[model samples]
Target chain A: MINLLFLPLVIPLATAVACLLAWKNQGLQRIISLIGSFLLLIAAAVLLVTVQQDGVLSVQGGGWAAPFGITLVADLFSALMVCVAAGMGLVVAIYSLADTEAEYERLGYHPLMQVLMLGVCGSFLTGDIFNLYVWFETMLIASFVLLAMGGKRAQMEGAIKYVVLNLIASALFLAAVGILYGVAGTLNMADLARMLRESESSGPIPVIAILFFIAFGIKAAVFPLFFWLPASYHTAPMAVTTIFSALLTKVGVYALIRIFTLVFFAELAAWQPYVLAIAGLTMVIGVLGAVAQDEMRRLLSFHIVSQIGYLIMGLGLLTPLALGGAIYFMVHVIAAKSALFLATGMVLRLTGTTELKKLGGLYRHQPLLAGLFLVAALALAGIPPLSGFWAKLALIWSGLESGNHYLVVAVALLVSLLTLFSMTKIWAAAFWKGAVVNGATDTPLPLSRRVYWQMAVPTALLTATTVLIGLWPEPLYALCMDAARQLLVPDAYIFAVLGVQP
Target chain B: MSSIILSTTIRLLLPLLLLFSVFLLLRGHNEPGGGFVGGLVAAAAISLYALAEGVAAAHRILIVNPRQLIASGLLVALSSGVIPLMTGRPFQSGLWLPYSLPVLGHVGTPLLFDLGVYLLVAGMALLIVLSLMEEE
Candidate 1:
């Protein structure tokens, strides 16, 4: 029962310990990490199935119920997110085995990666706001270590900016949590949601909500607060960047969606317009920034900002369909974007640089790699029959159904085209053009079969998932719909966490 | 580089600081002092020793790796949660001994969990300090 909920958190933490113990043994560390990640995926899948069958599942810590103690709750949305996060964990662990240097392994890379997943799973599964903050700190600390591990000048620069900005974000979130607890006399999210609704006092509540909005906004990299993301994301190791792209910002978006829907449902009208405007600006600015980038990972990092804009846009529209679309978009983008980053990593591995100006002839040298990148890129641009297209269709249909946001709908279309343009720019420069005879391409050696499988297999696995989800999106869509239904009517979650009468 | 006065002062103060940290850790469950504060106190004591006796001496005193302490602490904390699951209870439930224990009275899983936190924080602080000292 509730033991099931603890598995995801426990597995990673246990693995992290094993990894630390195996610090001198890189091969053993990799094996343990892989097995742990595999177990996490299985646990998450089981949790999702259980929550799907049982509605919402909540477990109280130390037998203390509701507002009295910490809880771990897995509604459909959180469960799905956990499943996706674990999937990323597994893939990144595999990718790291091939890509990370031995020096990093000695410096506790595997353990930190495991701890990072632990924090992510904890964040997605926790039922208390303060617990969420703790999990955020856990994730941030692990990420800080991972980002700065190499101690290169570029890494130090990026890590400093990332560290400073995220510290500000954490402080804001903590301050807001303190104010919220003071106002509501509780730290449990369900209890606060209930209390915030019942008490007709909306004075400090709106101000508190604004603080939360800004806090999560910075984490989510929405419009005005996104400068830190592109600056730092490109500088991390490829495996590190892939996992960061997959889970970090999405956690922020998940927080926004969770709080806005559950706690701030009553105040949607006050915030909807602002959320919408931010979404639109985030989309425009992010893609425009991507278009101007010449480096592969930097451009992809900017695209992360733009895709986040779309996810937030669905929440802004505030309908079941739109929310469903947002959740669907989040999952699709996680898969597609991780695949793209892995592919970019492969390009960097082969060509020794991610600079579009220097990278070329990938199509000639590695057609499979080129094809996988194309699939992810096309999927990202919302091409037909891909996962992104269906996700966008759902959002746009919801937009039209809600009436008179024609401009927003048009902007969504424009962003997709711009996404297409930048992706094609990568394709043309990195794959289609003739080989660049430069310092970056000194030898141009082909990978061995083992090396190819170790590297390409993970990207191929992720790309195949994107294609599979694209071709048969019905099951995922249904899950998103169920998740959306739960968000729209949170009585199930509230009751699950706070009991029937609370 | 160290002064005899500094060394002598630390030799006298370190044991008291460590004793106070243990006192703080034991009283944490019902009082204001907890694992985090106690761990910081212990780390401060270690830092003081490092400053007085040089980092090489401090390293000899701390024979085990700080990373191992962290890992063990986390494992203990996670085990505290998982053990309750075996008895059909929720995570981290306060399972107690049927009889009162000698010296430390009425021991339970919450105390064990706090001990885990204590080790983790102390290890983390030591790791940072040792790494910084190494860099210098």
Candidate 2:
């Protein structure tokens, strides 16, 4: 069904509305959100399959032609992204059933979460630059509320930093869009790509590209502009943080890849060195930040930043192999990272805190959770036979093949080691080491059996996904390679959207 | 802080402002006025009434909960987009009536979409204003 292209955006919007309508009944809201998320996952999967079979698919809104009306196109890259995002949304929806407090539900957590999904999916599927900006704002506003839902002191402080920095990024994005439109006279990405490629004069495009870089870099949490991530990610509820960790930065990276390959492909060579350098720095600094953290979610937050480096590294390499690696790495990281956060959420539920030093003896008390954490943690560290290993291998292989990118490869390897070390630090301190003889451990909070299972199931499911991808990497890897080819050669995408053979 | 002059003026002004907002909403299809500005005018009128009377009276006058208004407005807008899909058109394709109505001119999905935006914006503004005023 061609109309399936709009389902990813529509399903979530409808779900959020349904949740809002059932506001007074928290139980009803939960059921609605869960079903909505499940339906979204199915729709996304169908969309992905349709795209895989049909090549790039584009739909114009309100019966208008592309380059004029709003367009939603799904090539392999976007379809895959939407699929993974919907999967993450489903997992988080399940986890939120038990993880979210009734008060937050009353405060519209379910609807806000669905709105966030809508924004994320819209960003992935939109074919217009200005439309992408609108989706980003939609995601931003939903996340802002989700972050500060409880109005806790730390959340407020964190939300302020998050909002202000993100607002600046949005402003930059808008300015870039305005400038680009002024120069090219079109906001449709395919039209822009064709115009930019055909135009003899390339004046001011580089400036616009750099503006987009900084704007998206802030969202992606690349080296210099990633301060807001760690400052705020841990302050939100774990489920919120999990979704944020899974989708938000990846959206930024996806935008980077999309624009660099499509609209700004010409300027990529001029900007390659800067991107690679930033990737290296982001990886090193993020892991180092993780090593210094004793809090559970905070450590994971830093790791999120570090892993973003690898995604960017793939982009910087600018080869089909490298881009495929980056896409694969994105899927791997979403599963592995979200699992880690969900497990940490479990730890918080049982222990009432995420401070690693104050947590111990989990290996004895809750071996299942400990095991789940270990699997995801090792995956994050790029252990063998795990999704992360293959992701890293592909990136490293491409880096070496690219030649002269050895420094980043080395940084990446070293960062993997450091990531392992940080994971071990968490394992040793929180799970392996004996419980601290403090008031915090004397009386563990009694987690209801249902809640425990609800939290654990999603974590285990995600871990299983990582293990599955790790064990059977061929299908996903092939998809990513095809996606990479589509990205590298933009003519197909351009033609699909505008009905003109570029 | 309630003033008799302000209250008396608002009682007469509220209906006129609301009628003006509807005019703006209908005229938006061909003119500069649209749902967003129209919603703002309506919200401003109601808020002014709240200031003269009280938040409780304003809530009573509104009848429906602002939150419900937002939810329903969103549903309306979404359905407008979906209507074209059933008719074998792309999602959100504007489908207008062949015949133009008196005063309103041509009616279409765009008008319905604008109506949704009108309700949503008005509800959103009122919700914020009422909450903030109640907090004070």
Candidate 3:
């Protein structure tokens, strides 16, 4: 029962180590790594069940006590993170098996992949404030490795900017922690929240929040701070970029939600409006960027920046419905975005180019793969009967209900249409035209299996999940409500930390 | 770039430093140290070796394989809490025992929890530093 929370952490970590130790045999490492991801998917499912029956689960360290030692908590929010993370990880791993086998052997690819999973899941589950910082660094480090994994000329060029930006973010995070510790005197989140309730930070809170936001903004790749993402994302291997595009930046967004809700709630009125503005700009700018791009992955990468605005917009709305909408959309986005990237990998594999000009008409040649791409793309565009529609519906409803009518209603409608526009560009550019069969060939295109065999299953599985949730969203909706409830009403969490009933 | 002099120093120090890091993690529950510090210490052990051994060798012997230790530690830490959750106590409520065997007898979830954190910090830090160095 209580074992579920730790499984997300354990399964991936062990698999990575085993892969590293036995990495000499690529076959053995791949099998073990796949098995590990499969096991984590199981673990994430069991965790959802546990959270269904139980509200929130906490683990005290070294068997000592809370408030003193670090803890890893699995509230509904955290559990959702585990499920999304593990689910995406499994999908990406499967997608990359064929996509990345050569790199897996000749370098440190397998180990880095495992470690990245560790960082991602850990960020989702940890209960401590400082622990969050550790997890962020954890993911950042893995991303650095992954970004520079291939050691190509462009990767090095892009990796430098990625490194400098994240390094500053990391330093700011450390300095913020020092202040948080200085002001609150505790690094544990629940304890700090409880402490913060008695008083709001005067001198340092805003500064710290900004610092934290900047750090996360850089990671999340928000409007102004997002330059690093497009610059570097296109340089990595298609598999690596796809995972980073789908998962990494969102980690920053996740932390933003965590801190703003728990520790920084006092400043919500002031910050929400600012966050709302950023969300709107992010969405608008992101779509515009996508519209201008000629490359499939780069355009999609820009879209990721914009869509995050949607998530942050929900946060700015700050109502339960809005917040739940954000969470739901997060799941939807993870599935849709990762699937889109994986589809790109398949396209890259077959066509030997991600350039919209060099390739076209993939739909006629690879029907199953094209179909998978359409479903994921439509989902990203918030079309009906897919998970994206429902998530958008919730955000819009929450917006109207809360009476932030203009930002929520008007911008929401505009973004949905724009999302459609950006997605259609990919549909038009990558799959619509007749197959070109270009002469700029290099390593030669792989003809191995049905694009769906290794690739389509993962993307289709996510798309199906999107559709299923769109069709009958009661269970997930209920779970998200419970998760949000646990977050908003902090008594249980506070009690978890202090054991005091006041 | 792959200097032998640095590698020899790392090789000479890896065992001793990691042993010290484990010491820091185990005793962190009651003292000034815990997962973060212990993790940093352990990560330091690995990163130091990475500088000395070349990124490839260091990745092989240390962090590349051992990041999973955190999860096992987390499981051990988390299971300590279930002892109470099953008995209708709140999540992570302490079941302390003031033992006859000096300080270590104070074994509880806090200690187990710290151990989990220690491993995670160590593994994660190593993950970042190693990956970055490899790129370099």
lDDT of 1 by residue, B67-102 (tens): 877887787877888788899998888898888888
| Model 2 bad stretches (over 4 Å) | none
> Which digits, one per residue and each the tens of the lDDT, describe model 2 over residues A321-360?
9999999999999999999999999989888888987888
TM-score of each: 0.96, 0.98, 0.82
List DockQ for all candidates: 0.73, 0.85, 0.11
The sequence of per-residue lDDT tens digits that candidate 3 reaches over residues A396-456 is 8988887755765687689789889878888886777765564323333667765448777
Looking at model 1 chain A, report the run of 10 residues with the lowest lDDT sum.
Answer: A439-448
Q: How large is the i-RMS for each model, in angstroms?
A: 1.2, 0.7, 6.9
Ranking by DockQ: 2, 1, 3
Off by over 4 Å in 3: A437-446, A450-452, B1-136
The interface root mean square deviation of candidate 3 comes to 6.9
Tens-digit per-residue lDDT, B1-136, candidate 2 = 7999999999899999999999999889888998898999999999999999999999999999899989988999999999998887889999999999998888999999999999999999999999999998
lDDT (0-100) at residue B100 of candidate 3?
41
Writing each residue's lDDT as its tens digit, candidate 1 over A398-473 gives 9899897777788888999999999999989999888788735545667667776788989998999889999999
Better of 2 and 3 by DockQ: 2
* Cα distance off (Å), candidate 1, residue A210: 1.3
As a whole number from 0 to 100, the lDDT of residue B90 in candidate 3 is 46
Predictions ranked by TM-score, top down? 2, 1, 3
